[model samples]
Target: MPLNCGIVGLPNVGKSTIFNALTSAKAQAANYPFCTIDPNTGIVTVPDERLSKISALIVPKSLVPTTMEFIDIAGLVEGASKGEGLGNQFLGHIRATDAICHVVRCFDDPEVVHVAGAINPLHDIDIINTELLLADLETVEKRSQRVEKLARNTQDAKIKTEASAVAKLKATLEAGKPARAADLTDDERTASRELFLITAKPQLYVANVDEAGLANGNAYTEAVEKRAAEENSQVVRICGALEAEIAQLDPPERTEFLESVGLHEPGLDRLIHSAYRLLDLITYFTAGVQEVRAWTIRRGTKAPGAAGVIHSDFERGFIKADCYACEDLFKYGSEQAVKEKGLLRSEGKDYTVKDGDILFFKFNV
Candidate 1:
């Protein structure tokens, strides 16, 4: 239930800097390799304007926003799969995460050191991805070896299928492709999941640019974006140092700084939103005068499953949910007006919670 994304890249790609900006935490951003030995975990509030709008109408004494966790993982290096330079430890941290934020350096500054000697965003991407694929290839090969041994001794169809699955995975990984790009059937995919391949996790690219490159991307950012498009991944442009400065300012001052920089909002917000989507997550609300709060759930989750996010008992005593759209309330100016127009309705356990839904649960327990 505690889903998180691991920020990963080579050394000094602004991974820690962007993380520091996102969480405003002092996680140590030194211009050197392996500065972050252990992954630094930080919880950040997921921004949603609907939460404030819902609070305004309901007049809650306290309002709470849902959060996502970000893990600033140690930088990966070439030959990481061969146990090079704290690679195994960092790769383990990445495996624990649900998704990945692959940070790429799209800026050049004399003060920051580049791990690859020069900026080649494509080569940087290839290095990190190759390491992950190599790691997964080893895992698949090992799993395949064990499964093949089992296959020769038994006539179990399931075991044979598993062996075949790992065979396919091995071939894909051997061909320098991630396990996700492998052509697997349903059973094969299920079998592949058991390996917990690092390459299988969904990912988005973060182009850490300078202040000038933020508004209009530079050549480096363009390269990163093009590479992301080729891989069918998303790219989020962020100026790490500037965002760190913006994060320290007061809300009023932050707004002023943004306007002065020709930005309507912080780039971190875009990064957060992109990561949320990469995880296939959605937010729903529970409204009341006591506390209006937002909750996170996977897309296409049923009402009972969503209720389970709050507490087991809510899901145990399953019932209907009274739900309305936050946008409807905003349009109508009040919840009463929304209800008067029949915008509110009761939904059964089969109801699929939406991103902007305001739900009121009806449970016996």
Candidate 2:
């Protein structure tokens, strides 16, 4: 996985608008479909409510949220597989992403043109998914041809394994199933994982709705829900225009705005947190008066690998770590109290980190 998601949808589906709101950077948003010719990449901070609480308790020089990468891909169109309307170029960008956030335009706007000439969520999804299937089919078929030669040769074990994996993947793709749907042995999966095929990653549909849709997600959301149920995918309904406005407000005003809208938090926060969990990412904190920062790591990250994210030296000379869960601090009110309560623990390199752990690393260098 690339540790990032790519935003994709048909032209004028508010992909760029959402991307700009995510990064708070201008990425050339225009009214027309395919206005964004090139992909715009952004690093967005993953918002955590716990970070604010932690900051309140232990004041730091700065509070930095863990970040994730988002790429705004050019809009994909029907007949894209046949190279219609810059489809081929756009598809290649999506293939490089770890996950896909398909932004379906569920809002009705006479001023903004719909690329498909109507506002049909299922039809739009099919157009994009069909193109992806076609692209993956091309890949599987091409790779299968070369692997067929090696599958018959008994001399090379590596080649034989690869050939088998490719054959399985080819069959899965031919059945209109994604590469991720293919069943492979542990070694085969490990070998094939590096291919970074687009269809192999999970997907979530983002219903870009209007104001009325945001409040209760009108008929458009219902359509998306039905489609998601069929595909076993999830839907996140948000108003892109509203989120963009919220992103511009100051902290205090932002909160006020959310309350006014009867929302507890910005929809972007929910979307980001959902993406974090979808990617199986967790945060562990390193806190001190000097700096208290959140670091992102895979869910099962062991001590050394988590430390390595800070610096190579931390892993290279790792001795042990002094750790206590943040929940312990919240309960005990202070580190000294945590120690007095016997909640603090000294862990060795083998310790697998738990979410909300506050760690202080010890090293030789």
lDDT of each: 0.91, 0.86
**Candidate 1 lDDT over residue span 1-365, tens digit each:** 56899999999999998999999999999989999999999999999989998888889999999999999999999999898998898889999999999999988888888988998898999999999998888888878879999999999988998999888888888888778788899998887777889998999999999988988899999998888888789999999989999999999999999999999889999999999999999999999989999999999999999999999998999888999998998999988999899999999988999989988888887
After aligning candidate 2 to the native by TM-score, how far in Å is the CA of 205 from where it should be? 0.9
Give the 10-residue window scoring lowest on summed lDDT in candidate 1.
187-196
Residue-pair clashes per prediction, in order, are: 0, 0
Candidate 2 lDDT, 139-166, residue by residue in tens: 7778778878867866687778788888
**How big is the positional error of residue 334 in model 2, measured in Å on the Cα after superposition?**
0.6
In terms of lDDT, which candidate is strongest? Answer: 1
